[model samples]
Target: MANFGRVIELTIDDMIFKMGTYAIEGTIPFDNDPIPNESEIKIWNLSPETIDRIKRGSIVAINAGYRGDVGLILHGFVSKVLTKWDGTDKITTVYVLDTDDISKRKVTDIAYAEGTLASYILRDMAAQLGLPVEQFELNQDFKYEDGYTANGEVTKIISDVAADCGTSAYVNKGKLYIRNLRYGADDVFMLSSGTGLIGSPEPFEDEDFKGFNLKSQLQYRITTASVIDLNCRRFNGRVHVRKGSHKFSATGDFMTEVEAILP
Candidate 1:
């Protein structure tokens, strides 16, 4: 019982709740991928008091794994909640999507001079969504033409520019990160064989031909940030996280799988 207390720490709308067994599914966006990555959480037998706070648009953060503090597996706003009853038990599930979902709705139309720097334009777009810029390394010299219009969803404009520059842009933890494909080597987190890695990393072909030509799939017992390093053969040291899903249950166990690519 004591161990269970240390295994899962969940905060929803700044309020913590004790749950039976829970699971979270997440995916990190890259390239032309959708913004604000999506996640789903299933909680067992939640108290009425806790469920009341989980209205649509509430904030949620999760920390799980046996060693306890595994960092944030998923952070986003609640989209929907479903309640179910299985004979003598009650189950509640919450759906979540990163801030991008909310920001994408805010449409804007702004014109820039022919020589406007890409960084400045990006900053302006992000500001509309109240998201901070993490890195704006898109070619500074790259400029839009005179009478060019920056319009539509704020995230769409940023992503279109990133796609044009052969880079990627996405939102994580309420921050916008723009960088070259597979370029965050200095910040890579090491995943050793003894750690969460389940089996030998499997190689697969990427269905998104435009995104990348190669992909490596990994399964683990937990989920971390959107990016990580698979310290093994054929992974090219670091892989950009494309998608991840975590499924945890009190009676069964916890597991997370990630699909990544090299550049």
Candidate 2:
């Protein structure tokens, strides 16, 4: 079902078969889409540690490991064909080399599918402090309410509800396995029911502290995002993202409804 439009190609060892262990080094997307679509396939999967740079007729670039932070970049193609002449002795065509072009080092790598890849890694760590990735807009919602002060002493007044896309104390832990791609069938994995209860955040605010130390200075925060709400659109393809309006939200199963063969 992957004929998308027709240009599907792949071979830098089949786009490294979705680098499930990282090593993708860099990548960012939003080419604006001219065609192709089958969920646009973000963060497909990767594990061999990646760094091979990619070999054999290389071309590579297929989304990324599951939960793919979702920015964009799942184009495809790479083929010289796995050659072999029946006449034996003079058939050579498997070659692929030069190619690198990529971005994105940490969004906690997807931070377990948390709110748009940690809001694009907190807008790439606030564009490395200089901020202004087109100026203020990576989400900034607020809603607070605090309670507690009468006497029992438990009157908590907590209501700093944020849901736009402009904050993060970056935390991550992922493990997706799924199944039917088959080998037994019940793969499983996909954890994080709040991983034992969201308790492990302390960027800083200490004195003589005894944990995670970066000289005490700290600033990291990504609030919320986790999309694809059309009932998950069959295995995940409706091209989600807009949780709090980071933007981009395509459907029709995220694109391709027939024909797809990109590599």
Candidate 3:
């Protein structure tokens, strides 16, 4: 079991925000189910040097975990920034989007002719956008029937590709994981009872009768992706993490709310 404590660190470009120096409260979200994952961090008491150094398009890194075992949970580019004054203090909120979001900004100038395999089209598009093809695992057997037209946004093109093949494409960590809608054992992480698991895992029914029931929910202090093993009753074997949110506050409350599906 790991020690009980909070780990929160943020860096923009090369300027690192030391703990107890600038940030006060923030939240970083992680998900790989379908949509692109993004994070919003609200920080208080930012110095002029820090504010001036950070701007839109700056690379940002957010790390959080228990004491001594902190990991880089989110590393992406800043999409937007907002600063406001609450009469007593200045609060700055930074919005960050993963590499997948950057792909959305690119549009394909060439079209995929019919008989072109989906994997080929995806590879071509990804290459043009500077995303390494090796980072993604695509279904080579899937082919385009009607072919695609030019001037299509890379984001939309990829979404259509995934939907046609009944798969999903999302950036997990720093790589693009494109695969069928099946959660394999390779996606497993440990959430021991006393290590990071906050309390008992609570079982619940899905509000909407669509997809698998996200039957289990728990909280932890670690921030990372992958299926989590819940050491508890009602949730045995591997459970898929459907959604998770990381909350980090300089005041010492740092945790992640995890929603998972029963195997």
Candidate 4:
């Protein structure tokens, strides 16, 4: 990607809004946690009718990149919309969550028979929530000998099932995914000076994991659990993304920050 001429397209319900020359600002964050990802976007100066269309619960999809390389970065329901005045500019901010309608719904008195596969239980939970399955990979499909009962919030239930199977479950781009922490997506993104690598990747360590913090020209393709082939002055190898954020603004801020660990 050339990393020139910023392009952003926001789709709200049936209406579409495009911005190339205008200012668009927002932050989109993703991770491997059980909860859905939330995004906050700000657009400057819109008509009253346009603002009216951006009500709560409206479907929203945001795509951005340099000119012709645009791609989907966020897809979810609008959780909130607020408009305010900044001098002569009227800014509208929209909050979105990447989960389906059943995020708040509860599963009551549902039980699975003994010897049931963990994958089947997860699929049924997803079906109940109306969330599509994007990727489901489990290293061990543990079978419950005493059977299983599903209760509480759908998100929690799904998380519990994943824990029993020794995996993690999360929603990405409005779809559900289950995988072990040691694994990630098969596709690899190369990051170097030529491919928008900003500076030397800084090394950090925690109690459980040690990884690098990376900054590069906004790369929309990178997501939670995506593999990165890093080629830099200090470090050169592959790492799996644990969490990251894509941040953009018309005031010269456009980049992707990632915290990744060796897998």
Candidate 5:
């Protein structure tokens, strides 16, 4: 049995991404839950470009291995605060909100990807599990610069939502992310000698880079942001939201609210 010594029960939400046996965790969730300390929440807090790149990276990682199911965001606000065993890691046990909870309103069971070799199989998971745009502190806003033709026609380049626009998510150093993805069935694959199979990007350096796959379809990074913004409405307390789904919503906040979320 798990130890229950001098136990104190507090509630919080959590997220994790599954790529084979490896899982990358996300933030703790709550719509308006209070966090006593600054360390309680750790949104990327990077430059706008970096934030976008992280989002793009997440999109790429999810879609890179997307079979069907969408990635999860275990979003919930802080319910109760604890003062003991407070390690550097910002984590706690959430109440584990369920669909039946009153304040949470609608709750849907996300498939555990029982059959697929990866973690998920439900394609609409991200779309169904996203939060609203209003609550998105992701800093995803974009800025526009203007250029003039020889005749001064005056053209503008939207550095935010265009392909190869170099607006990808930010990572360490000077590298940016390219989170493009596609799910067309006509895709083809090549096998690697040592690693087995990886989606084809370009020719591999060694003979082991056998699985050079390619896709004829394309989708935008913005499309990904919208798709995962669903379920942004559900919060903890009155309603019992699901464990690993979005509860805040930005469905109609497109023009003003969402625009401000960009880098």
Candidate 6:
């Protein structure tokens, strides 16, 4: 698709606080691991009253894409808000954490009976933490042979349980997801020169996996654990996104970067 007319919509506490791309700038990252994602957004020139209304723990959601197409990019809670003057232009920076409440909550002495499914345990934990379930699928339904006891932070407990089941758990847009490591979301995004694939996909290798790092015109649909069908000069196939980020700036830098691996 042809990329044009950048758009950004930032909503705080269920109110549309800012819209348009020219004055909004920052990075929003998504991950496939078992931790919450954090985003930092800086808006230029906001009234003092508006900035004051944004408090810690307030709900925030950001939507960004081209004018004709837009999607929810980040939905989370505000962790901090800071304002300052930059050469007479006041800038308000908002720091947000995805699923902030669930990550910090502790599960104490929660016990499950033997022969309990991991999914059941996960759902129970989600209820205890007050997190909504977006998607939950395990390659194998692991049953606790000797039952199980959950403790510590909810994220950690979910991570440990997922590890035992040979899967990964993560929260996206305020919901929980548990799936196999080699797989991703069901919807696949086709990326090519005609569809906003910037330059060529670069080959990369790390200790755990080998994959490609790709850049495209700020794709709001692509997130961590998303499937992308990459079609370029050097490579053509489907890869699962391990991690990626969407970045927009007033300086004309608007792009999506993803590090994906073969599944």
lDDT of 4 by residue, 1-263 (tens): 45678877889899877776456789999987668777998888988998998898999998877887879889989989999999999999999887655567788989899888888888888888787787889878989888989988988888888988878888789888888755854688899999988989999999878889999898888888878899998988988888899898865768899999986
On TM-score, the candidate that comes out on top is: 4
Q: How high is each candidate's TM-score?
A: 0.77, 0.20, 0.79, 0.91, 0.15, 0.91
Q: How many clashing pairs per prediction, in order?
A: 0, 51, 0, 0, 47, 1
Query: Looking at model 2, which ten-residue stretch has the lowest summed lDDT?
Result: 213-222
Q: Rank the candidates by TM-score, best first.
A: 4, 6, 3, 1, 2, 5
List per-prediction Cα lDDT, in the order shown.
0.60, 0.22, 0.62, 0.85, 0.20, 0.84
Residue 47, candidate 2: Cα error in Å is 21
Per-residue lDDT tens digits for candidate 3, residues 53-115, read: 788889988776656667777877888888899999999888887654645556746767888
Better of 4 and 5 by TM-score: 4
Alpha-carbon RMSD of each model: 4.7, 20.5, 3.9, 2.0, 23.3, 2.1
Off by over 4 Å in 1: 1-6, 18-34, 139-141, 207-236
Error of 6 at 109 (Å): 2.4
- The true-versus-predicted C-alpha distance at residue 33 of model 2, in Å, is 20
CA shift at 216, candidate 4, in angstroms?
A: 1.5
The residue-by-residue lDDT of candidate 1 on 1-263, one tens digit each, is 12243355677888875444444233332232427666666666778987887899898777655553455655678888998998977878777876647444556568888767676776777777777776666643366655357878777787786676666677665667777545543455566555455556777674552222222222332222245656654453666666556655555545556666654
For model 2, the superposed segments whose C-alpha errors exceed 4 Å read: 1-5, 11-59, 62-124, 128-263
